[model samples]
Target: MSSTCVSPALPDSKTATTDPLPDIAASAPTHASTLDWVGMEDISLPLYLAGQPVLARASAGVSLDAAGARGIHMSRLYGALRELESRELDAARLSGVLEAFLASHEGLSSVAEVRLAGALPLERPALVSEAAGWKRYPFRIAARSEAGAVALELEIEVGYSSTCPCSAALARQAIQEQFDRDFSQSAVDAATVREWLGRAEGIVATPHSQRSEATVTVGLDPLVPTLPLPTLIDRVERALGTALQTAVKRVDEKAFALANGRNLMFCEDAVRRLDDALNADYAPQGYRVHVRHRESLHAHDAVARVERRAPDNR
Candidate 1:
């Protein structure tokens, strides 16, 4: 006993300090009131969608429904988000993330939601030529869970060409007048007229065509096997008939022009077309269609919105 002296800071065998790390989040709130949702945003993550890898901006949130809990576990929401990186970004897979978020905050949360936003480069071919190129479409997927029910939403941006129907008809009227004026003085032979039709002056006017956009958002039906993202894109492009071309040669440009000439639509027409197509498709439980036609003749864009509701299979 005379050889050793212990520091006062050292604990005796009977008394000892346990864990010292403080968990402020687990403490009770000073003022008691529940919050709707709280978590993180603009998180970076990778997604494998439709067999393609894409970088996405991710966000996750969970409701603070428990009035007694000070705060929900934010770290748990971030941890659950990691699951998206390992699986194909789809309805079934993303639903797991939503479930995990609520499960991790079991006592504090009853609702959870996550959003993944990114640009998907979709390869499309020229309308009339063999050339092809890539177009980046802004895409988003949202998953939400309340109580025990889960819902998934898929959103995509599609660019295409829209020519005015009235403009085309007016241009045709002017051409007919031009034909009458030109042939009034000259002999009307089939060869001469055909040769004139091939010339620049023969086709004096062309209806204006401008780039248009369709923002299609659909709620997926649980019965669908996989995410039909590719098919959704294909359906929109096919419905519009004048999808924005990637590569453009002289031949391709001509083909695109032909396509626009064939598929003339106003903003009203676009929403109706997309509305019908989505309603007819079996993969979606419901859908919302929004289209904007950047008018060539006017400075403002013409817009339309349509919603179609289907049976809630969920």
Candidate 2:
């Protein structure tokens, strides 16, 4: 009687179940309400832009139109983003990704969107030297698929040097006053003035210049085949006329200084330059330009913004 007790056998994990695992998202919500957007953000991924690989942070989402469903399948949205790594990014590829997003969440979503943010590396040559270096321009690509149509947008940030117009005028006035004090009593001679101009005392006051940035966003026309990031960058840099240099010898530095002097611009001037450039050639559906000058003379930054819409778009 004392030896009669025995333990029962446990079920093997391998044979525990042949049935599917529970999916909570397939069930109804406790309180059903549709969400405007539902999905993932800050998903790290590798993206190819113009055949160059870049590390990107992606946000993928879809409108949650299914009021009864607990949630859309977030993994499906992430899976669709894999397309970004496979090929050079363009409007068509971006639209394809959005299409995949909607396909994966069909019947539960009508609108899908994807955003990619990364730095694009471009080789930049020195202004007056044979040397070259890589410059990373931060950019963002946003695309949405709604009502069976796709809309694409591109954004880029370009850095440049900006010399304040008012500051330049003020500095020139100060230098003129100083020159009058120095040469008022003496008869001015060309050779003597040349010697004086070479000295630091001759150019006593200098215009305030600062590292400035222009952020441009444009709605891409569907007919545009590729992502025109490099072209847009070139256009913006050319318009601004004093793009930040990567590698510089003394000659290049001097050339850069000369360029800045010749291209003195306030934030307003920078915005208008960008506006004219974008409107003239790269006619997007619409565009917005925002310029910021990080002031060396003041603690606060100077900023300006301009926006335009195509007549047809309006």
Candidate 3:
């Protein structure tokens, strides 16, 4: 009875509520947008090249913009490249890669770019012997898409021998005269002299043989796709006929010397040969060819660019 009387003294108005107001979170601040490009660089991977799988590394770049965001989704750019990992890096496959990159971002109108630099094996006949070995060279491929159009670029570095026509003729004439005067039955000089004359014998009649490099770029039409890399390489080598090679044997070396003699050329000849090869192969594709030769003779580099004119509709 005492406990009941004490409880009854506490009125309902004096009692406190068991529950408090629910916690509420403030809204996040919105940021202004800007144009941006993001991606991963120098990623190492393995790729199939020249019928063999070899290690390849790549540098990837992507760009996109949003209406209200400051930058693009950087992680997405890397993710796009990751998805392309195991896929072929050919012209067709590259289109898919660019498509995915562009699709990864919502507001981006232009697709990003991917550039891969790696080693490629070139099977070359031994210089002295008929046996063959592989030579590794630096290779690069770049691709990008803009306004629903895609462009692919391929770069390959190859070493080849260039014999001078002018020097060769002069050397031959000098050797003939020396043999006629001496009558010593020694038509050619010692090994050292022969080597020296071989290099010096050219059309230009210079002491030093010209060491040259060729860089060619062709603009491809989307409608006519596919890049015939191997074919192009073969055509180029055929045009020059003196491709530099490693692992040479005596027989192969002799053969190479003959080839060099057969295809002696100047810097201008080399550039023209490249142009002819490209024009013949890409005639239907409608591509413009650009050729540059780093000449050893002149201080300045020699460059030649040619574009096929548009077909007449009439």
Each prediction's number of clashing residue pairs: 0, 0, 23
Give the better candidate number (2 or 3) by TM-score: 2
Cα displacement (Å) at residue 203, model 2: 1.3
Tens-digit per-residue lDDT, 12-80, candidate 1? 757876777788888888878999889899999988887788999998999897777788778888888
- What lDDT does the true structure give each of the candidates? 0.85, 0.91, 0.62
Residue-level lDDT tens digits of model 2 in 173-272:
9989989999999898899999988889999989999999999999987658889999999999999999999888999999999999999998999999
lDDT tens digits by residue: candidate 3, 1-314: 35543444554655855566532311122654444556777887676655555577777666645444444555666666665456444676667767887887656436578777787777766755558888676567777887787777666655567776777777777766654555455565587455644553322232235445555555445443454555566677777777767777777877877877788777678777777777765554444444454556678765565566434311
The TM-score values for the models, in the order shown, are 0.89, 0.93, 0.70
Task: Give candidate 3 regions above 4 Å deviation.
Answer: 1-38, 127-129, 183-211, 220-227, 283-314
10 residues in a row with least lDDT, candidate 2:
1-10
Give candidate 1's whole-model lDDT. 0.85
Clashing pairs in 2: none
